[model samples]
Every structure is written in C-alpha cells, then in structure tokens.
Target: MEKLTAIIPVFNEQDTIERAIVSVLFADEILIVDSFSTDLTLSIAEKYDVKIIQRDYEYSASQKNWAIPQASNNWILILDADEVIGSSLREEIQSILNKKSTKTGYWIYRNNHFMNQAIKYSGWQNDKVVRLFQRDLCRYEDKRVHAEIITSGDLGFLNSKIDHFTYKSLRQYVEKLNRYAALQAIDYDKITDKITAYHLLLKPLWRFLKHFIIQKGYKDGVAGTVICFLQAYAVVMRYANLYLLRKKN
Candidate 1:
C-alpha cells in the first residue's frame, strides 16, 4: 500500500481546524501549515497527532507551493480548513492507494454550504478542485485568489464529494469577499492603468446577471441571490482597491 500525506494550510481557523484534522486522520501523515495564527488554532492543533509548521502569511499559491514539496509522501491530499472529506471519498482514496493508479491527480467536487444549508446553484453547483495529486507532479498557478493546480500528467475525477462549509454567516462571507477583493486587486493593478465607469458600474452589473440570471442563482433561492449580488460587489471592490493601490504606488 502507498502512504499518503494530508496537507492542510490555514490561518486563524480555530473554529474549523479541529474538524479538518479529524477528517483526515486516515492519512499516514497529517501536516498542518499554519501562518502564525494568533488564536487557539495552534493550541487545538497541538492536540492532534499531526506535524505542524509555521510561516508568515503570503499569497495562497506561494504558500501552497512552498508546502507541497515538504510533505512526507509523494501522494498528497490537500484539504482546506472548511472542507471535510466524506466517508465515500475516504474509502475511494484508500482504494486508490491500494493500487498502482495511472492518473497523476484526481478532481474532487465540493458540496458547498452557506449558513448550514446546501447551496445547489449560484455558480457553485459544480465546484471542483484538484485536491488529490502527487506532490512532484503538481504546482499551483501564481495567483493570489482562486489558484488552480498545474499538473503534468492526466487527471481523473472522484465520484465522492467534499462537504465545504464555506461560510458560517453573512458577516463572515462579506469579510471573506472583501479580503479576496483586496488580494485580487494586486493582480489587477498590473494590467489596469485606470478605473472607469465600465469597471465600477457595467462590470458589476454584468457579473450579477451572469450569476443570478445566466447561472440560475435564482434556483437556490435567497442565499443564491445574495451570493450573486455579493460576487458582483466583490468585483467592484477589486477594481476600486486597484485604483487605490495604483494611486498609493
């Protein structure tokens, strides 16, 4: 059987870190890459039988890329603090480890939830990520937000899903979007010389329409509608922040 290591990178996720660690206890090694969280995150994690390391917070891609090679095994499973692997997924992964698989990576779909309710739409219905992969065969794209894994070999998909408790409340969701907008603004600043009405107005409106109408966010009801609007707001905030960032520079 092949040994697998689970790498969970987090910062200030004390409320969710323990559950994340507990879900991956099946792995031969569990490595917690913390960004010096000034909370009970470290103390709670210390209770688990897992390897722990600390580093200053940077962009997501860089942090994940730096930790990938440090894993004890070549086969790696990366899980976020807010994601939990279900029993079917765990069994499927164990089955894969018991054999010589041809694929270098596997994509796992996420069942996203907001305020304890499952979200079936709002452009999140088919949310999938390359979480299980060989450490040597994959690396993340150089983006601050929404980084995709770049793999050399062919990838396959797992039938089971990961339960993603993305946001506990509306306040948390808004704060998360605000932080993402700020990080995304850094990348936008490289290309945007100026912000105009098109960015501030049309783009946000289009974003809202794309999600709420085109993507059928209405199907998910109130949560979906709110998420779509917030998504558009995030776009506006991104460019607005880019404008300020450029001005400061």
Candidate 2:
C-alpha cells in the first residue's frame, strides 16, 4: 500500500487548525508547518498525533517549498488551515494514491465560502489549486501572492472539491486583503512606471465590473456585491501601497 503525507501550513489559525487536521487524518502522516504563531495554535495542534515544525514567517510559496522535502512520504497533500476535505474528496484522494499512474500533480477545485454562505459566482467559481503532488516532482513558483505549482511531469485534475471557508468576518477579510496588498505592492513597484489615477481608480472599477457584472457575481446577491467591491478595494490598496513604497525609496 502507498502511504501519503498531509502537510498543513498555518499561523495563528487556532479556530480552524483542528478541523483541518481532523479532515486529513486518513493520511499516513500529518505534518504541521507553523510560522511561529503567538497564539493557542501550537497548543491545539499539539493535541493531535502529528509532527510539528516551527519556522519564521515568509511568503506562502517559500514556506511550502521549504516544508515539501520534510514530508515523510513521496506523495504530498498540501492543505490550508481553513480548508476541509469532505468524505468524497478524501475517498477520491485515497483511491488515486492507491493506484496512481504517471501523473506528477493533481489540481483540486475549491468550493469557497464567505460568511458561512457558499459563493456560487463573483469570479471565484473556478478557483482551484494544485494541492496533491509527488514530493520530488513539484514545487511552488516563486511569488509573493497567488503562486501556482510548477510540476516537472504531467498534471491531472480531481473530480472532488474542497470546502474552503474563506473568511468569517469583514474585519478578518480586510486584514487579509491588507496583508496581500502589502506583499503585492513590492511586485507592483518593480513594473509600474507611474502611479496614476487609472491605477487607483479605473483599475479598481474594472475589477469590480469584471467580477460583479462580467463574471456574474450579481447571481450571488449580497455576498457577490461585497466580494466584488472588496476585490476592487484590494487593487486600489495594492497600487496605493506601491506608490507609498516608491515615495519612501
């Protein structure tokens, strides 16, 4: 029988970490990569029979890249703290590992939820990530935000979807966007010639329209409207932060 290792990268996810761990218990080994959390996260994680490794905070790609080689099994399942694997998905993963062929990685689609409601649209309907892969055949692309895995061999798609509880509150969502914006600002500064009104105003408008109207976010009603606005706000913050970074330097 082929064994699989589940790697969960977390930081201060005290509320959701336990649930995440419980969902992946089917795996032969569970590895928790902590970002030196100053909360009950570690204490809660200690309750489980899992191997824990603490490392300093960095971007997502770098953190996962560092932890990939540490997994005990040749196959790795990367899971986020707020994600839960349902029975169907769990069974599907197990079935694949038991008789996998030449595929190096698998793309898993996420069923994103916001404020406890499953979002059906808002440009998030197609959200997916490559979480299951061969340890030696895959690595994350070097990116500060929204990095994808670069696989050395052929990739396959999974039929089962993950339940991703994205954000519980407005404050939490805003804080997350702020953090992402700060990271994105560094990349924006390198490519942007000048911070203009178009970047601060028009780009955000387009983002909102693209999501809310073009992407059929209106179908999701209130959640869709809010998400689209937040997406636009994120764009504004990215450029604003970039402008500030340039001014400082």
User: CA lDDT of each candidate?
Assistant: 0.92, 0.93
Candidate 1 regions exceeding 4 Å error are none
lDDT of 1 by residue, 1-249 (tens): 889999999999999999999999999999999998999998999998999987887888898898999999989999999999889999999999999999999999999998677999888988999999998999999999999899879999999999999987799889989899999999887777668999999999999999999889999888898889998999999998898888898
* TM-score against native, each model: 0.96, 0.97
> For model 2, which pairs clash?
none
lDDT of 2 at 249: 93
Stretches > 4 Å off in candidate 2:
none
Ten contiguous residues with the weakest lDDT in model 2: 186-195
Residue 98, candidate 2: Cα error in Å is 0.8
